[model samples]
Target: MTPTERPAGIVVVLAFAGITASLMQTLVVPLLGDLPRLLDTSASNATWVVTATLLAGSVATTVIGRLGDLYGKRRMLLVCSVPLVAGSVVCALAGSLVTMIVGRALQGIGMGIVPLGISALRDLLPPERLGSAIALISSSLGIGGALGLPLAAVVAENSSWRALFWGAAVLSAVVALLVWLLVPPTSPGAVGKFDFVGAGILGVGLICLLLAVSKGADWGWTSGTTLGLGAAAVVVLPAWGCWELRTRYPLVDMRVTARPQVLVTNIASIALGLSMYAQALILPQLLQLPGSTGHGLDQSMLEMGLWMAPAGIVMMLLSPVGARLSDARGPKVTLVVGSLVLALGYGSSVVLLGSPWTVMLVSAVCAMGVGLAYGAMPALIMAGVPETDTAAANSFNTLMRSIGTSVSAAMVGVVLSQMTVERGGVLVPSEGAFRTGMLIGCGLALVAAAVAAAIPVRSARRTSDHGVAAAERSAASVS
Candidate 1:
């Protein structure tokens, strides 16, 4: 569509919601240093500020995505902004780390905006603009993250870290108002009994799983508490899967997920999550470690934030390109290329992480891979499920990435724990452990690529059974 004719206002509102939701997490990265001292907690514990947000976001995304489908997409979008606002307020006033963690958890509710936004696009936007809009909103995950880090750093340097959350809170409220004003209201998308049982099982399972990941290294993964939780997870998760298969309105359709393509893509998404987390979690440590640590880059928070800033733009730039490619050749091809590029990125990091420029370059490469794989995911999901199932299916895809990142955090933590300093007293990554993690990530991305390739792409465009009826009405009206 021509620029003058485009529905820029509506799309921008969606984008705003997407950006604010994701920004909540990244904006906190630069604040990790001050949080421990400010809250009188250990640095390790302060990390929960990030972990809590991620965990809450992961669960909320699934639940809200389904509700958005069952209720109205636009209605859910409006409701999502409520938590974003509330979370920001809590974080702004949080005196201790515990309160901040709670606040962050609340902020996670905003993660719903993107997937639900995709659902909304199917209803609100014309077809010609749909693909590009999807690409942009999806890539907002990366873009918001990238932008949030630098913007937070700048704000924290000049003022207080608390102000950052306040700012986010304000931004979320503004977005909420804009959405209410600009986006059209519509009827609900699906009618079914909400899967209370499935939600409970999955929520408990993930909380256990994430708690294990986030705290295992601190608590000793082999401790009774850890082992007991692990054992319960093994039992509970399978039981949940069985329960889902039997239920009519399952929280997750484990049956459909049993498909090779879906299963493999999820597996790949997890790996990519792990690989992506390494950079997000690890590199910042590497960059800011004191010069006393032989290999430390010794960069200030702002400098490091600036250095990492360009990666977000690269991701934004590649998203549509990947989507276009997916449309022409297939999403599978785009996903495959993304995974390989991601592997190449980690490999590049092994060689070039020491230099600022090199680190940025490798980051851009990884961003490109993320753009490809992430961009392709929705298409894969929408193609596989009936129209009524769109929100739930996409929610699962989103969940996989969350699980993947959490798992990666655990794996990376283990690797870093086993690490030793070089002869020069620089923190030297265990070459074996580091390479092992990267190679695993690369392998996972490869698996995702293969899975994407194997998924039988429909020869023709997907014709939605229910939503299509509305589209037909609109078309006839225009004629």
Candidate 2:
């Protein structure tokens, strides 16, 4: 059947693909404590399971998005599924740390599916149906993450940890088959020589920067390795930018990316990403900590995840509402409102840490903001860029969010590690530290709101209308 004939099938298939890819983000969370024992490795070495995925995903998201714009997005979508399935299988059979990290890195390479799926919506769906479909796919990242934790916790507690990877393998294989059978092929969005040099340079720079951000706390923030990687990122990223600007066929169109609308939206995205993650880090710790700390809820991992799972459901349910808000008031206003809601969620955490119910309430509110913001970001980005650049622009925006989350993890780690209370001779994070983390999230959310509010409203509307008209023309020609 033609893409237009089955748009709903395409959306559901792609959204499922996105959710399957994002599940990698939290799949290993439940096993983090047992990884060293399971793999017979040191604690630090075991961490590479998580860090490898982050580094791989960060690099692969942009590169794959660019590839999708050059080749058929459907082709790239299938290609992405290969590694996701393979990685899950590898991880399932992994008996050592090296094998597990290798599998995780492969899984991360598939992270581009979310952006690719979002871009595909623009290609396949009518403009009227675009907003809500994009909203659902974009928010799938949070949906998968919030839901994966509880499911993983349950499996890890009852069965072999390998069962988690085996399940992932099956889910990924199903997503791949669905995409192949259900999602129609789209025309390549751009024609250009693939920028191998830019991809490599950007990969190197990102690896350096993310490695430092994610590992700094464990590696000693002042250590030579951390400092050196940080220095390399500082130098390498600028060089990569210069190369991109000079290249005839750039991996990322720096000129388009420098537009006021796109730039401001990206800036706001970073802050929103940071704010979104800060709560994810702090609240689970608060929930799992012993109640003796005066602020802890003393919940099991499964219980904590169950409490948080509602937030994911809330995000899923709110997608269409956010779409209506964007349709009525513009994506800029939606973004601003979402950021404010996020700030409100964090701010309320200051006074609501007394019980799991209050904590769940805070999480649901924050998820609502994230749902609105995530839904609007792509609309804002796609509005600013030509249709040809949709996937690349969205991928870059996704990268910005990744950077924000990395920074948040590092910053929150420092705060929680330093301000610890002695609980049975163990240095657990104190109540004050959790509060401070929430305040930090709150402040960043406000910053996001302010930045989003500054997006050039008139220019964005003009560009968006022009983009839509051009896309319609292109589709007519294709048909």
Candidate 3:
């Protein structure tokens, strides 16, 4: 059926694809402690299983998003599924750390599905139906991450850990089938020779920057390896900017991205990403820490995940509400409100960390803000960019969030590692560390609100009107 005839089906399939791709982010979390034993590798080597996925996903999201715009979003969506399925199968069969890391990296390449699917919504859905669909798909990253933890924990507790990857393989295969059947093909949005040089340079720069941020704590913040990667990123990224501006066809259009509306929205996105991830890092440990620490709730991984799963549900339920707020008051207002709510959530955590129930309340409140902010971000991005650049632009915005979360992980790690209490001769994060992390999140969320408030209202309205007109025209053509 044509997209116009089955827009709901298209949205459902694409959102499912997005959720499946995001599931990879937390699929192995339940096995993190067991990884060293499972792969018969050192603890440090086992960490590569997680780091490889983060690095691979960060690079692939932008590249694949551009590819989707250059080719067909539907075609690229299908292409993305292939690696997800293959990676899951490989991970299921992996008996070594290298093999598992390779599989995880391959799965990370599929992370483009979310943004690609979001860009596709602009092409396939009526403008009226667009906001809610985009919101749902955009929030699927958190939704999957939230829900995957409990699901993975359960499987890890009851069955062989390989079953987790095996299940992922089946789910990915299903997503591929559903997309092939339900998603309508879209014409290439932009025409140009792919910028191989720009992609390579940006990839190197991102790897350097993200590697430094993600591994800095483990490598020692001032260690030569960390400092060298940080220095390389500092040098390489600006060079990449110069190359992008000078190249005939750039991987990312620097000129367009520098617009005040897009620029500010991306800045807010980074802060929101950092704020959103801080809670994710802090709360689980807070819940799972032993009761002897005075602040620990003493929950098992499964129990902790179940308590946190409500946050995912809150994000899902709030997607349409956020869309309506955007429809009524504008996406900017929605973004601002979301940021404030995020800050409030974190602020409450200062007093709420004493119990699992209270901690869940904090996570749910933050998830509400994340749902609102995440939905509005792409709307602001798509409004600022031309229809032809939607996929690449959205991908870049997603990359900004990834960067924020990476930094968040590093910063929180530093705090938790340093502010520790001795428990049974082992150092565990002190209560002060958890409170400090939440306060940092609270500060970043306020910063996000300020940045979102700074987005030019006039430019946003003008570009949004143009984007809506373009979408209506595209829908009309399809009909």
Q: Poorest 10 consecutive residues of model 1 by lDDT?
A: 462-471
Query: Which candidate would rank higher by TM-score, 1 or 2?
Result: 2
Instruction: Give the clashing pairs for model 1.
Output: 294-426
Task: Go through the candidates in order and give each one's C-alpha lDDT.
Answer: 0.75, 0.90, 0.90
Q: Report backbone clashes per prediction.
A: 1, 0, 0
- Residue by residue across 26-118, what tens digits does model 2's lDDT show? 999999999999999999999999999999999999999899999978999999999999999999999999999999999999999999999
* Per-prediction TM-score: 0.90, 0.97, 0.97
TM-score of 2: 0.97
lDDT of 2: 0.90
RMSD (CA, Å), each prediction: 4.4, 2.5, 2.7
Candidate 3, residue 177: how far the Cα is off, in Å: 0.6
User: How does model 1 score by TM-score?
Assistant: 0.90
TM-score, candidate number 3: 0.97
Model 2 is weakest, by summed lDDT over 10 consecutive residues, at 458-467
